[model samples]
Target: MSDSFGFGQRFTPDEMASIRKSLRDEARFGSEFIGRLKRVAKRIPFAEDLLAAWVCTRDPSTPRRVKLTLLAALGYFVLPLDAIPDVMPLLGFTDDAAVIAAALAAVAGSITQQHRDKAKEMLADL
Candidate 1:
């Protein structure tokens, strides 16, 4: 939990605590954001399976940078940390969505077309 993001930089416990507090404060704003995430999740045809596959591939075979980026993205999804506090009402989750979308876009090349196809298939059901 004390890992650094880059050269000579680290997130202290205090910073992490502040982040957690911010996330908690933003939770109310997260409802709409969560809804948007659900919609995006729905769009992925085989989202559950693809997510499982992505998780299963957490071995050395996966590129370190890719893994890190994915972890960051997944964290954005599951973690409460956000640039825009989710407590701000309608616009609160906008930034969160943008961040997650950017993260997903960055790693899109790593995801196989088959995964996309499957996700699309699953999304159609929603």
Candidate 2:
């Protein structure tokens, strides 16, 4: 993707590579998120929040920065490894929750009621 952030900002090769990876990860985020969510839905209290963020991130009307932020958080959530491993029983998702919390705080208003409603519906069906 040669898409620019529209600020004329230039990225180093490594940064560009990371951007490409983020795009790829974001592209696959929805399915991967759902698969993992189904397995861990009973554990995480923020499933609805995560789903709402995903809904907003996929919305074309959402701002690029908000989508990027949500995608980065979602990317971290789906990763097999991170600052804390996801295999721990009770503490596994703290890092994921913190990342999601910060992302939601940064883009709080971007997640509209429609997105939240969709999230609720998705959660009900889960």
Candidate 3:
């Protein structure tokens, strides 16, 4: 897992690490954030993929760039406005899904079955 995510081209490992921690910390206590996600996870088409990203972020083996990319994608999921607003009923989550898809593609090899299993566990707990 030495390969860079290639998408997080702007941030160094230290910067990415900081950003990852910041986003994780924000979501850890962010009832509003996690609450919103939990409510939408069932309805969102790519929710599982995004959950994989979230789990991948916490993985010690995930590359820094991948972690940063995952954090950015997940962080975007919590925002009110992005490429498309998350309030448009059905189409709102499309952009978020696309972002996750792209992130997943960028780090194709990094997102392992382990991440998917962890994601499923967390989503079930949610």
Best by lDDT: 2
Better of 1 and 3 by lDDT: 3
Q: Is candidate 1 or candidate 2 better by lDDT?
A: 2
lDDT of 3 at 35: 78
User: Can you tell me which runs of candidate 3 are displaced by over 4 Å?
Assistant: 1-33
Tens-place lDDT per residue, model 3, 1-126, is 233444534767786675666576654635555677798988887777877877787789887777767777777677666888877888888898887787788878888999899878878887
Candidate 2 — which residues are off by over 4 angstroms? 1-16, 25-27
Clashes of 3: 0
lDDT against the true structure, per candidate, is 0.51, 0.82, 0.75
| Residue-level error in angstroms, candidate 3, position 22 | 7.1
In model 3, where is the ten-residue run with the lowest total lDDT? 1-10
Query: Which scores greater on TM-score, model 2 or model 3?
Result: 2
Instruction: Write the number of the candidate with greater TM-score, choosing between 1 and 3.
Output: 3
Instruction: Show model 1 residue runs off by greater than 4 Å.
Output: 1-62, 87-89, 121-126
The sequence of per-residue lDDT tens digits that candidate 1 reaches over residues 1-126 is: 322333233446685564455345444534543454466664433345335334423445555555555544444655555777656766665765565566566555566666556545544553
* lDDT per residue (tens digit) for residues 35-85 in model 2: 998898878999999999989988999987678778878888987888888
